[model samples]
Target: MSQPSVYPSVSPGDPSWWFSDALRAEGGEKPSPSLSGQITVDVAIVGGGFTGLWTALALRERAPQLSIALIEASLCGSGASGKNGGKVHGYWASLAGMAANIGADGALAVARAGTRAQDAIRAFATVPGRDVWWRESGNVRVSAAPAQDAKIQLYVETAKRLGVPDTAQALTPEQVADYCRSPVFRGGLYLPEGANVHPARLARALRKAAIEAGVGIYENTPMTGLTPGSPNRIATAAGEIIAREVVLATNIELAKRPEVSRHVSVFSSYALMTAPAPEKLAAIGWNRDQGLADLRMFVHYFRKTVDGRILMGSGSGPISFAGNTKNPALTTDRASAARAEKGLRRLLPGFADVPVEKVWGGGIDVSSDRLPFFRTVAGTRIHYGAGYSGHGVNPTYMGGQCLASLVLGVKDEWSTLPLCTRDVPKLPPEPFRAVGGRLVRWGIIGCEEAEERGVQAGVMMRGAAAIPKVFGLRIGTR
Candidate 1:
């Protein structure tokens, strides 16, 4: 008889097969002891995930003498950092959208910063003793439908116009099939700068590196209250911390604050990992390790693991009601996992018989403009950055560099990128936000379905897709 699935339903990203088992191996980093008494530091960073960890490392690199303390609600890599699809690529694909929001010059600056960030990750991944399973095998943004193909064509034109010709190149159907056998793929855009890695391993490696660099890390320590004083104070469950500066790298948790929450919405995304299918993958000619994402509004991102299993994710999962990121419902949903698995099967028929090894879900903080922004919170000593729209793997590194610059009060190039702005666009409030979100979601699905059927979307569907654009928002599978 077939053995029962261990994770029959979706659960928090924490106990996923990827992070849990690997973390238990001999010599895997253990959670740092939590803070228990009053203490002070030069910099106090909340959130031990990618953003905070990167910030700690960046600070040490720039100012080796500065004392830094990083507090986490759980162990490092327990959140999205460990649970993500492990895609670390630049933001060149969003150049047109960035240019529309910030002028072309500003957009170019952001793109350059993104490129630098990608390179930084590449360097870190290859360094000795990291063991992060980093692979710079590039990525492919493919099209399986007529509408998606149309958008891919526009993206290629924009990349060329933006002088990023070497960043992305068009791929013929035959060429795309050579990389990954998918009959639905009409064409693809290949980016050689993209990379994939073992996310949990990277996070753990960052933790080890940060500690070795003399940064104090306290896990299982949650920051509960913030008191604005001459020097800001952070209250934790069993201790208090006074700091010269604070960096709030808590990505999804930013929704709890009105100033930042209004501009962000929390949504859940699901993924399914298949049992090792080395023979099947070879049979399908999917020998390349490049990460792949389809051109649907709600993206279908898939990549092969170092162990040869395919990990597939779907972005069209549940959204929080009333723009609340703290909604417990955002944690997990089995239906979402099923949908993601179905998408994976549709893309690769060769995996039809492969048993799913596990299923998981996690929250993502999406901005109204579908781009990340960073700046000091108004009238406060805190610096913050979030809103990756489900594409944060590499951007978080850029965010860390920007946060480090702000904490040091340095007015250099990293601090002036388009993302380092004070004006973060806000979404509509409650009822309207909820209703409008449904319409947009339904519209995206409708348009994608029409395209799959080789037909144009109807008036309603078109209107729904245009709603966010009408409000000057960018939404697509990037």
Candidate 2:
């Protein structure tokens, strides 16, 4: 296949440009090219988004003299890292689900590491020229229906058992209305550790800090192939890099390469930002700033931007092969924005008239279990971390640190996290993969709808609704 134009350009230059705008506004020392052609480095990191940049930064801090090279297929932050909902909340995926695969101790270790990761991000924000609109106010997960409220309760109870300090507290219906202005919400959980940041700005700042610390970064450099031997060589469009260790931080983009395609699946997520909602911000008391997410299977996540706009996101529908490979597309279909707007209006009715100023979409790597995949590729010195399952912002920061520690042979707190050697089962082939994705999405939709109707919705009901249509099985419910 011919190489595609992955370079990020600003307005009038590229159709996908919101992330580039955010980066330019943050101001950073532009990364210099990797001009010294055939160079040797202690570590060579592919994919210059959050994972790659964070890994490079952490490695430099640990061993400043270790040579490192970071390469980006496009500009840094061009992936989901830049285009996500900007809610740096705690991991929303079920810890119990992860524990089922990795033991309870393993799950707790990951959660504790996430806490540390959030702290690391905040610490990074404090450095001069690296500030990126970090907001420390916590995140509130609202429950849109009564059945969903049950799950939120279970989540709170589980958090306490896991020794999570300040376990999410339940809000009374009145309290929910007072805080969220959403009468539709029965109750919700308030988590104190969650925070939000401008992801694009943060990614660029990380890249700048890494470069200043002597890490070489090359933009518009795609790793086409790799030869994994004693001193692994990574071949790119323009040149090749030889390094003692390699870190694959490509995430969803990993599917483009045959080496990782079997290990992950790419899913598209779409988001929209409204023109500044000053009046609405004042009405909801969100002027203090807190991110918000809901309890539905296809959840809605929203946050108050420093610029006074409400950034809301949803829609993770399966896309066709062509759609998946093409540039990001902004669509008014599926009524996602309207659905998001309705949810937002429930939270702050004052913004019912606020017009959406921008809409963008990006891809996330999702494993079958919905937990992150962190492991070394077999037969290679390459270490990889991907499949964050739509929770990458904070986790990626911590994951990067962990990856760096592993690469540098430092056994620290990050190094002890369950991520280092976890193995995710390989996904089935393309047609099956696509079919399974649609089935899962459909099942989720059915369950959500049934729950809204006050019906008891179970996993069996979800499976029954979708299995025959997509999976070609009856698989009678247990």
Q: Best candidate, lDDT-wise?
A: 1
C-alpha lDDT score of every prediction, in listed order: 0.82, 0.70
* Number of clashing residue pairs, candidate 2: 0
lDDT, model 1, position 59: 97
**On residues 1-478, what C-alpha lDDT tens digit does candidate 1 reach at each position?**
2233333666544466667745975266567899999999999999998899999999999999899999999888888888889988877877777777776787778878888999898898899867787877899988988667877777778788888787778998998998988778889888887889888888887888899999999999999899976699999999999998999988788877777778887777887788898998998888877899998878889999877799999887778776566565566666677768877777887888788888888888888777888888777779898888898889999989999999999998788877886366778888777678778877877787677779988999888877886876654323
Clashing pairs in 2: none
C-alpha lDDT of candidate 1 relative to the true structure: 0.82
Best by TM-score: 1
1-478 per-residue lDDT for model 2 (tens digits):
2222221221211312347567567564354564336778889999888889988988888788889999888778776677777677545335655566677788877777777787778888877665588888788778887777787777777777777646477777777666667546778877777788888878777777887888888987888888998899999876889999999898776667665667566666666677876777777555566678788767778887777888777754444342254433323233444455555555445666776666655666666556675666677778888778788888888778878877866777877666766665666678876666566666766677677678866877576455634643211101
List residue ranges in candidate 2 displaced over 4 A. 1-18, 24-31, 34-36, 256-259, 319-349, 410-412, 449-478
> Distance (Å) between predicted and true CA of 189, model 2?
0.3
Superposed by TM-score, candidate 1 places the C-alpha of residue 434 at a distance from the truth, in angstroms, of 2.5
